[model samples]
Target chain A: MNDDALPPARAIEFWFDFGSNYSYLSMMRIEALATARNVRIVWRPFLLGPVFRQLGFENSPFVLQKEKGAYVWKDMERQCRKYGVALTRPSTFPRAALLALRVALYGANEPWIGAYCRKIMQLNFADDREIGLPEVVSEALGSLDLPAQHIIETAQSDANKLHLREQTEAAIRRGIFGAPTFFVGDEMFWGNDRLDDALDYCEAMSRRDR
Target chain B: MNDDALPPARAIEFWFDFGSNYSYLSMMRIEALATARNVRIVWRPFLLGPVFRQLGFENSPFVLQKEKGAYVWKDMERQCRKYGVALTRPSTFPRAALLALRVALYGANEPWIGAYCRKIMQLNFADDREIGLPEVVSEALGSLDLPAQHIIETAQSDANKLHLREQTEAAIRRGIFGAPTFFVGDEMFWGNDRLDDALDYCEAMSRRDR
Candidate 1:
């Protein structure tokens, strides 16, 4: 398959949870990656807490698996270095993500979703700040020239909660068990590092159709 | 720190699950890696089923995430090709691992634990066969001129199960949630690909001590 032959690359739907460190990496890079590959990105923010609960997990997999957890922290450093992205471990993980998720969901339809999402991720991962706090969230929105009250108000609405729930269930149906998952047609790629491979697959599939 | 100034490398305890695909890759390459780096390797095999159960994962993460599952199969192909290893999807996944895990636990006292572990991994991953079946497990053992029954008997003993359980608990206590996990002193590297970086860490630590 050639890169130009398949249907124009479908919007790459990114289902992420704010508390996920790897998701932070993917959120930071998705825009540049999409532009380079001529693909579109759709941000879908959901609660990993719910997913983990359903899967019987009390915390992040890194905390559950000693060796894997240790590796991930170091591996994150390596990846950040490779990508030339600055990274500092978040002070408190599994942070209360309700507000951040609500904000992202509220901004889901805005033209500035990409910028807003990146900022939130950077606030937590790169800046080592608490993203769950209302004030921290408000400040991030204020810097974007977005009205914090409007975003928070929309996020707190029953409509938005239902919307978020539906998306989470949809992700479950789509076979997603973690944050930072991507799909192209029937193919799924998990983790931030797999972003390039996912894009390559789309490019290859497009070529094949041509 | 300079690489040569490091202290002598401490033995690496390799914790593996028989059914893990990545573990298969690591088991195959560990010897060559250990030799080149002059580090001792201690083979530790434990049951992933129990670990998963404890972590509340009913199946592989790939299976849980549809998009991820799709991407993983293809990615596995790409990675296998890169490593020049055969990549065939095993017919039976989460294969019955009782016998295979037992063999590993039984061989813990032997000098050939590393070599024997590698052979089983190749047989399961490279040959795309079921490692749980006695015939398949025995054939792999016979090729090494080891008595299959003796290994099986040892693996089935209460002592081995106790040992395996202890190791699993230790891993959990250490915050390990996945296979192919490596530890150098207190530094942890989680995946097979991270072997080089883990070795780099070991080299650095050894130098610092000197």
Candidate 2:
């Protein structure tokens, strides 16, 4: 088969947390990048809290490692400036991401996933707001013209919670120990900045298969 | 006592590998950050190749994890564009950094230390040349009007080799598993980007001591 006749690259899976500053940068850019590369993106939000706990981390890796923490803030600033995104250090980090993740899981099939993610990240980092606060989240949902009551109610359901838990376990099984992970085929790329390279690899694989 | 009259913050030791792309970014920027925050930066050059081998990694953590590798390359590109640093992926990675690191160690006490590091990184990443090449290194030294022979001879000396080894051992003992690690007082920060926060912590400490 001619390479030119091959199917285009498969969609990318982006797993992220609301508390991750780098996730904000990736989410903000993933659309444009996907469009440019002609690849689809699946937004997957998961609570990093459980992941960190399971990995024996009491806090963000940055906080546990001083230099890493310092760089994370500065790097976040740099990325935000470059992307024309507003970012401020959140007052509380590692905020309860459960509700947000649940909302995302239920909305996974919806077209509003990308916009909701961008808004939540901005609410946490750009506005320095507590994502765990119901008011703050409700405000974000209201802005999106989303049914805040329905989404929140569905997100808190036992079924969705179990699904989110199972997904986290799956991520761990796949060797993921961090937030902002991406997957192309069976390859797992951790961190937000890797989106483009993930897309490239997928494209390459598709071409090769053809 | 006035805050302005306080002693400088305790120095931070930065362990880096010249061959590390992220380390290059930190090395180039840490000095300015240190100066601004009234903190001293002690540059430590060690061999990561040996460390990786010991850890059973054949290459960078990114490469060992496919998803991470993709993100790192793309993220690096974005960072380079943001920092106005010219960069292209090196054709060969994990270049023999021993010679370059030795030279860096030899020049640690000299004023040319920063300039030497910047030039070497530029040559390797920006210019896409073999930094391990003796001629390339000599040219870099020549440009600085330094005695390339003397530096090279010193770097290859038994004493320097022992020092490098000792430093690597010290890093391992300190829980360092990667390049661009920094230690400020008892706090450890890993990765080049954390330099700013390291400096900030130093400044805050200085203020508190007053």
lDDT by residue (A1-210, candidate 1, tens digit) is: 121122345556678988898998898888888888877776778888777766667888777765566667788897788678889988787576788888787777688888888888888888988888898888889999998888888888998888778777777766777888877776777788678877887788777777
Off by over 4 Å in 1: A1-7, A53-92, A106-111, A126-130, A146-162, B1-11, B32-40, B47-84, B87-115, B126-130, B133-135, B144-175, B206-210
Q: What is the lDDT of every predicted structure here?
A: 0.76, 0.75
Best-fitting candidate, measured by TM-score?
A: 1
Each candidate's DockQ: 0.36, 0.09
For candidate 2 chain A, the 10 contiguous residues with the lowest summed lDDT are A1-10
Please give me the DockQ of candidate 2 compared with the native complex.
0.09
Per-residue lDDT for A133-188 in model 2, tens only? 77777788899999998999888889888888877776666666787888876666
What digit string (tens of lDDT, one per residue) describes model 2 on residues B84-201?
7788788877567678888887777688888888899888888888999888888899899999998898888998877878777766666666888877666666676566666766
**Candidate 2 local Cα displacement, residue A96, angstroms:** 2.0
Please give each candidate's TM-score: 0.73, 0.60
